[model samples]
Target: MNKPLVVMLGGSGFVGRHLAPRLVAAGYRVRVPSRNRNMARDVGCVPGVELVNCNVHDPAELRRVLEGASVAINLVGILNESGHGGAGFNRAHVELTRNLIGACKEAGVGRLLQMSALNAGRGTSHYLRTRGEAEQLVRQSGLAYTIFQPSVIFGRGDGLFGRFALLLRFAPVLPLARASARFAPVYVGDVADAFLAAMSRKDTVGQVIELYGDEVLTLKQIVEYTARCMGLKRLIVPLPDALARIQALVFDFVPGKPFSSDNYRSLKLDSVGGVDGLHRLGIAKTPIDAVVPKLLGEAGRQTLLDRNRRVR
Candidate 1:
């Protein structure tokens, strides 16, 4: 019997890095479309995974990639503002979803997993509002699709908590925004597993599942947890909402502006997943504390935790 084929869009990213191997292990042939094919070359040796270069925004190219695939997963998203002066987060989040859905329908792809974010429907911020709109489009696309709405994803190579870990090593005090906005950050590995579950089960088709960590915490609490787990002595200073906006505005022009005015706006919204979908999926959540020590270096982990205990 031939294995099913699953074409994955945005396969070079953090989530993709974790997901590709799982799919290959399950006897499914995986094809990845990335701008820089070389970044994904390591995946080529994983049994049946292939890589190709294609522009995600181009419908024709997307269709070509989607052709004859039993399943497709779209994981493309940009957190920072685009330099093209083009569509902001709104277009990248909502408009691109519309384009991908149409392309998938034309290519006759039967199964799709649309990746979305938690707390996305209430229009909390421009970013979240756009995410909500995109979810609505997918829900009404008439395709058998599974939506994976995950909270902030963290892992060894994650862009979220990992970056903070790096900063705590050098910076004396960590200045953060919306420290009160709570999150139940899901692990990248768990997120990948959720995708695999969605791919294998027809029951997941046309369903929306939310992924989250076992622990719910504020932004400051997460930073503290990471610092403690890494064994670091650092002070976490919470910037007021207004001041955080100013800081983000000042740093907007910085290269790799992961922190920006728009990002600050997004922090105002709580990032926990709702029970409506999470309970139905039966996917248990992993807390950030359980895995931080493993991902952090031994020395750093000891130092941070030692310092954290003293401070507390």
Candidate 2:
């Protein structure tokens, strides 16, 4: 019997780096699409996975990719827009989703696993608004689908812990906005497990799973924990709402959009979840202590090794 094919959109990202192999190991042939396959060569290198350079925004391309696939997984999401409006967010989230659904229908793909953010649709930021819009599209798509709304996801090369480790290492004092904004940072491995479970279980179809961890941590606490895990002593400055807005506004224009005004607005609502989806799915939630410290330790070792090599 031929193995089922699974198409993974945005499968070159950090989450994809962790998810692709699992699907492959699950006895499915995985196809990963990327705008630049060379940059995403890691995914291509995985056994039982195929990586293609394609623009997912284009409907024709999406249809082409969706062909002969039993399941389609969309991990495509952007925290910040290219411009200072909802247009970019809409295109990335809603429009692409709409196109992906239509393509799925046309291609007769039966299953979709969508990656969404927590508190989607209830925030002032374009990020959450677009997330909600995309979720709505998915709900109405009439496909066998499972939507995952995760709080922040943390792991190696993840935007949360990995990002803060980089920023925290350079500064003696870190100024943080929405310092009280809380989250249950879910482990990437757990998120992957959720996806695998949903994929295998028919009962999860059309259900929305809220994925989060055990500990409810404030933004400041997360940063502080990152510093401690890395064995560093740093001062953390929590900014009031007014100055936080200023910081977001300034950072919005930063080259890579490390921060944004819209982000601060999204932070107004805590990222903690009411229901523990990982628990509901029978997966143990990984606490920050179990994962973050070990990851930071490895990163510290890597940095030292690199420095020693350079010195030679």
Candidate 3:
């Protein structure tokens, strides 16, 4: 018997890094399409996973990748854009979704698992608006679909705690923006499990599942917890909304865009969820304390070892 094939768009991203391995473990052959195959080499290393060089945005290329695949998981999203306008967000979220849906139809792929964020479609931020738009597109696409809306996700290699840990290592005084913005950081593993569960269950089709953790913490609290985990004594100062906007503006021009005005706008809405999608899927949510301390402690040790080697 041949294993079912699953094409995972954005399978090299943080969440995809976790989910792709699980998909392979579940007896599915996973195919990940990336614009640059070299950048996605890690995902390609998975035993049953295939990584192909392809631009998913191009309609013909997307259809070619989806050909003969039983399931398509769209995890493609961008937090920050290259320019000031929302065009980047629209293209990544809404336009790509539109193209994916069309390609899925043409290629005979029936199921789509869309990765969305909490509070999608509620705020004026381009990120949320575009996510909502993509969700609507999925709903009306005439294909069997399940949408997973997760609050800020955290785990090994996560952007939340991991990012703050890096910033705290060097900066003694961190000027934090949206310090009061609240989030129930969901575990990436739980989110991946939710996707897996939904894949086998017919009832999950047409359902929009909201995934989040138990603890509701403000951004400032989350950063403080990260600092404590790393045993670093860093002063985290919360910038007022005005200062936060200025900071976003300044970083907008920065090379990597560590922060931007779009991010600030998105943070205005709290990321806490009302319904527990993990519970619906019968998956226990992993708490922050269960994972963060160990992950950060190990990371700190690795950093120390690297520094000692450099000194020697």
TM-score of each: 0.89, 0.96, 0.96
State the TM-score for model 3.
0.96
What overall lDDT, based on C-alpha atoms, would model 3 receive against the true structure?
Answer: 0.93
Lowest summed lDDT window (length 10), candidate 3: 298-307
Candidate 1 per-residue lDDT, tens place, 1-312, comes to: 888889887777889888899998878889998788777776655667888788877889989988878888888777766552325876688877888888889999877898888867764466777778899999999999998888889887887678787778778898888889898888888888888877777898888888887678898988887787777778999998778888888778888885877677778778887763544556665666677777776648555676698899
Model with the higher lDDT, candidate 2 or 3: 3
lDDT of 2 by residue, 128-175 (tens): 999999999999999999999999999888889889888866778999
Error of 3 at 87 (Å): 1.0
Candidate 3 per-residue lDDT over residues 1-312, each given as its tens digit: 999999999999988988999999999999999999888988989999999989999999999999989999999999989998899999999999999999999999999999999988988899999999999999999999999899999998888999988888778899999999999999899989999989999999999999999999999999999988988788989999999999999999999898999999999999999987888889988888999999999877877787788899
lDDT (0-100) at residue 101 of candidate 1?
Answer: 89
Give candidate 1 misplaced runs (Cα > 4 Å): 83-86, 276-279, 298-312
Model 1 reaches what TM-score against the true structure?
0.89
How are the candidates ranked when ordered by TM-score, highest leading?
A: 3, 2, 1
* Best-matching candidate per TM-score: 3
> Rank order by lDDT, top first?
3, 2, 1
